[model samples]
Target: MATTPPVIQAKITSDPVKLPLAPLLVSVVVGVVVATAGVGGMICYLLRSGKVPIRVAGVAPVVPTAPLKTHMVALEPLLVNLADPSGSAFLRAGITLSIEDPAEDKGKETNAGEAKPSSKDADAALRDTALTVLGQQTSDQLLAANGKERLKAELKSALAEHNPTVKVADLFFTEFLVQR
Candidate 1:
């Protein structure tokens, strides 16, 4: 028996094989197809839902309101003596208010169906109500830069209760004096 073995029969090649491009092309095609499908689905969903505009509660625009007519009414000065003996001083103050819808008396006689409200009536009511409120409020309440603001709001609320149609726009302290 020969121990050397048989001669080689296969051929030897050294050339490099080219890799297939099909895998990269398939990946690109799949990505494009998925992206298009996702976009188309989103658009179809939006259109099928009817697309009604959203409404936010308490965010509606307020319609313009009618302008109220204003009239200024002047009041007599009020004097107040402090209750405390140590800080006993008298304060004198006059108040004027810009009132809206003052009750007025037209000379023209109305038919049996008359007796509607007048500007003068509204003005008089506002003046009386304002004077009462100011009288009750102390000088500190009426005189303080910030406290005066509170007094104004209180006055408006007070007036509104008595006269619904009449509105108090502003309070003008024409004169404020103190004496010992």
Candidate 2:
């Protein structure tokens, strides 16, 4: 006798399962509102805490700067004959002096107001010192690549001999002409 095969059972539904649209939309809207509120709160906190730099109308920010050490002053041009063996070379140079700020000086003051000479007095004193220094330089010395720097250092040293309070910062030759 042949055995009959076991019958298979099957269940079928006509309607499809669907997710509720209202709940999904409500959740999305709640998430967006929460995110927006969080961003707005952060912005408000930053503004209130003064962490953000805000420039107001006609208001400038106070920035810290290093104290100025040196200042520049223009000096009258000097015409001097160079100390050459042939004595034919001469130099005409317009020198600008970079002087140290006396206000920033920490040295002890002895004479105070009376001892501190005016810039005009200092310049007048510097004129003779400059002429002496230039007159001592040879044509080759003034014409070299490092001539100007050497001259500046020499002049600073010479000027210091005359006036210790008048510190020389630098020297610039605006017009340099050598005549032989």
- The TM-score measured for candidate 1 stands at 0.43
Which pairs clash in the backbone of model 2?
Answer: none
> Residue 70: error of model 2 in Å?
3.4
User: Residue-wise lDDT of candidate 2 within 1-180, one digit each (tens)?
Assistant: 999999988878789899999999999999999999999999999988999867779878899986555666777899999999999999998988777766745343344334333467777888888998999999998889999888888988898898797778777889899998
TM-score of 2: 0.53
Error of 2 at 53 (Å): 31
Candidate 1 lDDT tens digits, 64-148: 9756555466766766664335466666767777765444633344455543444676667766776667556555554567866
Candidate 1 ranges beyond 4 A from true positions: 1-62, 82-87, 102-128, 139-145, 161-166, 178-180
Worst 10 residues of 1 by lDDT: 101-110
- Give me the displacement of residue 88 in model 1, in angstroms: 2.5
Model 1 misses residue 8 by how many Å?
A: 24
Best-performing candidate as measured by TM-score? 2
For all candidates in order, the CA lDDT equals: 0.68, 0.83
Give the Å error, residue 96, model 1: 1.6
